[model samples]
Target: MTVNRRFTLAARPQGLPKDSDFLLTQDIVPPLQEGEFLIRNHYASIDPAIRGWLEPGGNYMPPVPIGDAVRASTIGVVELSRHPDFTAGQWVMGLNKVEDYSIGRGDGFTQPIDVDAVPSPTAYLSVAGAVGLTAWFGVEDVMQPAAGQTVLVSGAAGAVGSLVGQLAKRRGARVVGIAGGAEKCARLIDRYGFDQAIDYRGKDVEALSADIAAACPDGVHFVYENVGGACLDAALLNLAQGALVVICGLISEYNSAPQGARNIWQLLVKTATMRGYLISQYLDRFPEGVTAMAKLAGEGAIVYDEHVEDGIDNALPAMLRLFDGSNQGKMILKLI
Candidate 1:
């Protein structure tokens, strides 16, 4: 019998997730049935979105039932197969359970990944995968800022935020980013090519909003928001007439009680629009986004960063990095 190690959601998180919220256990691998395949997962994606599924009331997805392996998006190699469509040693990417091995039925987020196409297979989890996908649709389909317009992206040093700014810049938008610390803020201006970067650390809503106002003196035409709370509020105060606010994720409120934006009245005053979006809603156009993003990255028009943790044991800490603003880019658990 083969033993599989898994991390199950042990408890609903109270605030930011803690190690106690998960349980590590082992199970004997059952024999494969018809149309089943087993995967030896190579990497696990640690995203802020995972926190929503842990809540008792859940967000977009249903609550991860307690005792099931915590849900994650993963990339791996199929090691064994009883399914006719899959073969051993093929690379795959999908929404997978956080475990050493997973069973798949060749459907629902499960698809073969081409390992030789990019610099490495891991890019599929970062720039070429969900991270890039989210940024592409948010900027191109929703925000759609024209040349010479001003664009602002909160959580700017992160995977999605970094790409959002670059894509907007490609369209000739004057880009400004909001990050947490001096280092990340510098990276936004120096590495990602933002016209300005605002460091939000230790700053209240008033101070942050003032910084945003100074950065985009012409008023912001598009706000690609990742962090909510104060970040969203600041962008609201600086909205230009006909501004568009694209809400991707609200990391600031994901783990805690929601703090509604206080400056929403600015929307009415400026005749602006605010819309929330989900990447999954644009599945039909993923190929279009992927091709454009990969081409830009290959041509040096887009850049990205990654922060990797060494083992499954470190998954809890890696996920916490999102809330604390410690992670420099996409957070991944390197299980291989």
Candidate 2:
């Protein structure tokens, strides 16, 4: 008998999740039935979106049921398979749980991955993964920043925001990023090549808005918003006429009660448009996104960072890095 260790949601989190909110449990791995496969999970993708799912109603997906392994996207090798498509030793990626082993049925989110096509297997969890795809589609499809337009990105140093800035810049747009600290802001300019970077460390909404206005003196044409709350309010104050705002993720309110957008009325004043974006809506086009991102990454046309924490024991701590702004880039938990 195989014993599987699972990280389960023990209680509904209040504000940011704590260790007590989750439980580490051990269970026996049952024998595979027909059309079933077992995966030895090697990595888990730690994302801010997971915070939303911990809520009672959740955002998109249903709330993760209590006492079950926490839902997450994972990459692993098929250890055993009774499914026709999935075979032993094949690498796969999908929406799985945070556990040592996952059972797959060759349907839904499960899909095979060609490790040779990427620089690394973990790349599927970062640059060529969900966040990368989100950045690609958000900038190219939704934002569609034009040459000479001023594009503003919130949470600029994060996994998706960093890519958003770079992709918009490639379209000839002047990109400005908002990050937490001076270090991240400097990286936005020196490393990611943003036209300007604002440190929102101690600034209030009014102060941040003023800084945004100064950076985009002509007003911002496109806003790629990842962090909501003050960031969204500040961006709203600097919107150009006919500006487009794409809401990607709201990390600020994910851990707490929503404050709602205070300056959303700026849309009326500026005659601007704002739309919520979910990457799952583009699932049919993931192949297209992966191909494009892979080519750019392979040619050194794009760069990305992954902050990988080894061992499943570190999953909670690794996830906390995102909310605290301690993560260098994309967060990943190396379970293997």
Candidate 3:
């Protein structure tokens, strides 16, 4: 019998998730039934959103029961199939438990992957994946940032943040990124073509606020918020009238040891519409999101800077990089 190794949730995390919060075990892959197909996983995405799933309360879906494998999106190739819809050579992405092999019912799943369109499977986990879709939907359907407007993106060097900033840039808006280091800031401006990038590492909030004001002379008309808390306060200092603030994910508050984001009034005075969006809400518009992102990617209009960790064993370290502000772009695990 073939065995599939998976990462199971045991004890919920208190603040920053520890490796001990996960329990790794192997289970036998049962034989496929009438319409089932067996898949061998290729890559798994490790995102900041996964931290929310570890919490005891407040989740888009139900919490992962103790001893259950954590819920995640995985890309894999069909190794064997009894299903008529799926073939042995076709590639697919599905919501499956973290493991070496998964079974698909050939239902709402079985999203096809085009190997000719993209170079690597990593894209399926990044821009083609949920994070990429999040950037597209948030930028278009949610924020709708326009030309000549100024947009600020927090955690601008991260997976979703990098893509968000570039989308704003592609729309003819002045893009400013908030990153942690000079290197990341340089990559944001030089590599990603952001108009300017602010390094928040050891920098005062007022200084960052001033820097943002300097970069965005007209003021920030649109904000793609990722890192919340103090960064949120900084973005607040330079708000344009009727600004659209799209909240996709919050990496800052996920592992809060203490309180964060002292200022909340910026939204009120500037008449800014700060809204949080969950991807589940945009299920119907996913194809549109995919088309937009892929088209941009195909034309070299979107910048996808991936910070890759090659192996499932590096999942813990790679995921923690988000909270630590160390990752340069979308972090993905390359399972060999």
Candidate 4:
């Protein structure tokens, strides 16, 4: 008999997540029925959005429901198949949660990738998969920045934030990035061609707002927000009359008790559209986003980064760091 290891949501957290919140265990796998296949997971994604899902209330993504293996994106290879669509040895990625193996019908996943096209199997979860696609679509669908307009991206040093800024630059937007430190800020501009980078660590919101205003003399035309809190407010204070505010994420607010939106009145004053988006709504456009992002990545127009930790034992601790600004880029667990 085959066995599977999984991470279950053991406890709901108050602020930031802790290792105790997760419970890891193994179970015997049952025989596959018709139209079913078994996958050996290669990697699992750790994202800020996962923090929002752990809440015990109404979030756009359904709550994990205590005692269930947490929901996540995983990349793996087919090990056993009773279905014709999924063949053994083929690599695949989709919503596989955090299990070492999954038994599911073929309809839930994309066709497996050619190992020759992408050098790493993990690239599927990073670039062509959910992370990169989210960044690509956020730039096109939400920002739509025009030539000479300024697009401000918070969490600008991160995987999604970095891509969003560069893509905006391709469209001729003056790109200003807000990252946590001097090192991250340098990487944003020096490495990724961001027009200007602001280090938000220990900076006052009013001062930060002034700097952003100075960097963008015409006021910001688009705020591709990823970090919420005072950084979000700073961006809010300097918006142009008709700017689009892409509410891609709110990493700062994830650990706060009873998460709330602040400085919302700025929306009405600037006549700005402040919209919250979830990737599930954009599933229909996944391929288009994937193609464009892959093209940019391949052409050197977009930069990609991943902070990989080895083994499932580190998954809980590694994910806890995201809320603390400890992660350098997209966080992934490399499972053997």
Candidate 5:
């Protein structure tokens, strides 16, 4: 018998999640039955959205059961299979628990990796994964800014925000990023090629808005919002005529009640549009998004980073990094 290690929810989180919220345990993997396959997980994605799943109430998906393995997007090799659709050696990406092994068809977000198209398997969990798809649909489909327009992204140094900014640049739009700290601001301008960067680390809404106004002198035509709260208000106050605001996520409020956006009146006055989207809603167009991202990556037009931890034992701490803003880019747990 093979040992299958996993992390289960120990207690519901009170506020921000703590290490004590999860319990690491082991079980034996049973032999695969007809049409079944076994996966040896190599890497797992730790996303901010997973926090909502840990809560008691209904969300975009049902809350994870009290003692079940915490959910994650994992990439692994098929170690054994009795299924006609898969072989023992293929690499696949799917929604799985943070564990050493998994069984059953990983239904959602599951697909075989094309190694020739994407040279790195880990890219499936980072730039070419859900992160890139979120940025793609949010920018190319929803926001749809024209050339010479200005796109401002909140949480610009992060996984989705960084890709949004870079993709906007490639589309001939001037890009500006709002990030916390001098270091992240510099990375936005230097690494991601944003035209300007505004540091929102410790500023009040008024000050942040002023900074945004100065950076976007002509006003912003597109707002890619990964962060809500004060940043959303500031971006709203700087909207150009008929601006489009794509709400990708609200990382700033996931752990607590959100501070209301006070400047939404600007949207009314400017005749602007503000809408939210979930990537799952565009499942039919995933192939288009992934293809575009891969092409851009091959041409060296897109750059990405992954902040990976070493083992499943560190899953809780690694996940906590998303909220704390310590994770540099995409947060991942490497289980192999």
Candidate 6:
């Protein structure tokens, strides 16, 4: 009998989830039913969006039921199959639980991956996965920043924000990124080729807005927002005449009660548009996004960082890194 160890939601998190909120439990893996397949999970994608799913009123997806395995994206090899589309030994990536094994019915984000396509199978969870695809669609389909436009990205050192800045730069836009510290700010300008970088630490909306005005003398033409609160407020205060703000994720407010944007009024004053963007909206075009990202990655046109934690036992700590701003890049758990 296969023993499956899972990180289950022990309790609903009050604020920045504590270690008590999750419990590691084990259970026997049941036999594969007709049209079902079993996967031996190797890597688990630790994303900020998962934080929203823990709340009683979840965003997009339903709240993960208490006592169930916390929902996450995982990459693993098929260990058993009763489904025709998947066979044993094939590597797959999909929306699954953080566990030793996952049962799939070949639906909802489950797909096979070619390990040789990138540097590592984990790339599928970073550059070639949802993070990269989100950046791709957000830039190409939504923002569509033109040459000479100033594109501002918040949480610019993170997985999706970093890629968004790079993609905007490729489109001939001058990209300015806002990160937390001097180190990340330096990386934005030096490593990621950002035209300028703003360190949002210890700065209020007014101060940050002044800095943004200085960097983008004309005004910010486009905003790829990941961090909300003061970052979004500051960006709003410096928008160009017809700016477009894409709300990707609000990492700052995810763990606590919403401190809504105070400068949202600037949107109306600037005749700007602020739209909430969900990656699922572009699911039909995922293949196109993946192919494009893979090409750019293969040509060394793009660069990304992956901070992998060695074991599932370290899942809670690894996830905490996202909220504390300690994670270097896309956070992944090496479950195997």
Top candidate on TM-score is: 6
How does each model score on TM-score? 0.96, 0.98, 0.93, 0.95, 0.96, 0.99
User: Per-residue lDDT tens digits of candidate 5, residues 1-336?
Assistant: 999999889898988998888899888998898887899999999998899899898479899888889988888999998888888899988888899998857456777777578757788888888898998988888877678899999999999999999988888899999998999999998899999999998898899999999988989999999889989999999999999888888999888876767888998999999998998998888778878887787678889988999998999889888888999989989998
Encode model 1's per-residue lDDT on 221-334: one tens digit a residue.
999999989999989999999899989999989877899799999999999999999988977776777667766766677888888998888888888888888888899889
How far off is residue 43 in model 5, in Å? Answer: 0.2
State the lDDT of candidate 6 residue by residue for 1-336, as single tens digits.
999999999999998989999999999999889999999999999999999999998899999999999999999999999999999999998999999999988887888888788888998899989899999999999999989899999999999999999999999999999999999999898888999999999999999999999999999999999999999999999999989999999999998889878888888899999999888898788788887897788788999899999998999999999999999999999998
Q: List the residue pairs that clash in candidate 4.
A: none
Please provide, for model 4 over 218-246, each residue's C-alpha lDDT reduced to its tens digit, 9 standing for 90 to 100: 88888888888878888988989977888
lDDT of 2 by residue, 1-336 (tens): 999999889999999899999999999999999999999999999999998888899789999999998999899999999999999999998889989999999776678887888788888888888888999999889988889899999999999999999999999999999999889999999889999999998899999999999999999999998899999999999999999999998889888778879998999999999999888888888888988887787777888889999988888998899999999999999988
lDDT, candidate 3, equals 0.80
Residue 124 error, candidate 4, Å:
1.4
Which ten-residue region of model 6 has the weakest summed lDDT?
290-299
The C-alpha lDDT values of all candidates are 0.88, 0.91, 0.80, 0.81, 0.88, 0.93
Candidate 2 whole-model C-alpha lDDT, 0 to 1: 0.91
Question: In model 4, how large is the Cα lDDT of residue 66?
Answer: 89
Question: What digit string (tens of lDDT, one per residue) describes model 3 on residues 111-185?
Answer: 767755665677777887889888888887788778888889998888888888888777787889998888998
Kindly report which residue stretches of model 4 are placed more than 4 angstroms away from their true locations once superposed: 108-111, 258-261
Quote the RMSD, in angstroms, for model 3. Answer: 1.9
Minimal lDDT window, size 10, model 5: 104-113
Q: All predictions: root-mean-square deviation over Cα?
A: 1.4, 1.0, 1.9, 1.6, 1.4, 0.8
Clashes of each: 0, 0, 0, 0, 0, 0
- Which regions in candidate 6 have their CA more than 4 angstroms from the true location? none
